[model samples]
Target: MTKYQLFKKLPLFAYVNKIHVRYNPGGPNTETCRKLMLMLLDPKTFTKHPYLTFTYELLSFNERPEVFLTLVPQVPFRFHADTCTLDDIHRAIDADQYKAHCDYLKRRSIESKYVQEE
Candidate 1:
């Protein structure tokens, strides 16, 4: 897919706490990583995820490009950008966010049940 195709709206990052990206600007294969970072920095993305923190590093030309996501429960997920498409990264984050939401709802239900019992 073309790089512009990856600029579409991103899924809600409700469960994500922090995003860290490492990419080499001069590297020919780091286009995906650069595009991903741009998407994260978009105004619409910021509006959708107000509480998220974003940090990025420009690596040397010899280094690999990677993205790291820190979930609400302090879970760390890593993705290699050079070998994956933007869609792949989005799908993985979407799946993890869904799981986190489900886990949150489950915990809340259990807590409410105990409170009702008390």
Candidate 2:
């Protein structure tokens, strides 16, 4: 696949399992956005293989922390402090660890197919 094509390619998991995460540091939607986004993107579903997106609703800006989890499941995903509590974020990461473990098993099983030679 071409680079652009690859970019366009949507992982099956993305469609099968998906969540919308929205967060705003401050303003009218701040409170609701933070809670809702955290719930939706909770890492508990890591094994489920979902494409999660974290969106910033406000234009007023500061450099957001590197959300490694949102981009790379191998690393723990960080929830923005301004928008979420530390405990909440940690719990999600804890849950993700279990799910990631399970995912490893599932992948091994699928890859274990022994193709017989004719």
Candidate 3:
């Protein structure tokens, strides 16, 4: 299946809680994927805060087990590289926030639909 289709099947939380890579770092789609993750994962309530920055770190190959993306939240929270599906991540997140995110996506989707019909 196409990447977009796969992403649609996953929960909104998955976009933030996990890393979604389509190609290597310099590939055209790489930045798009990164931005998408940031948009969904943005910490601000109601809207995303543009002032927040997104960053990534790569450890030397000598480091232990495996390499994964680390999200440095202003506040502490649990994060991991486990291979859980979107539903799993959804269940793990705070209920109210999950609902808010879903609502945000729904509103955005409706807005896009209206734009397309215009």
Give the best candidate by TM-score: 1
lDDT of 1 by residue, 1-118 (tens): 6566643443646788998889988787888878877788789987887889999998888888998888887878888889887778767777667777777788678555534563
Cα shift from native, residue 115, model 1 (Å) = 7.6
Q: After superposition, how far is residue 50 of candidate 3 from its true place, in Å?
A: 3.6
Q: In candidate 2, residue 8 scores what lDDT?
A: 38
**Highest lDDT, which number?**
1
Off by over 4 Å in 3: 1-52, 62-75, 96-118
**Residue range 1-118, candidate 3, lDDT tens digits:** 6545532343333334333333233333234344445554666622533333343543333332221322223212333322343344445554544454565577679565534663
The better-scoring model by TM-score among 2 and 3 is 3
Model 2 residue 86 lDDT score: 39
- True-structure RMSD, every candidate: 6.9, 11.3, 12.0
* Sort order, lDDT high to low: 1, 2, 3
Model 2: pairs clashing at backbone N, Cα or C within 3 Å: 69-77
Q: List candidate 2 stretches off by more than 4 Å.
A: 1-52, 59-80, 83-88, 110-118
lDDT of each: 0.79, 0.45, 0.39
Candidate 1: worst-modelled 10 consecutive residues by lDDT: 1-10
Candidate 3 to truth, TM = 0.28
**Alpha-carbon deviation at 36 in model 3, angstroms:** 7.4
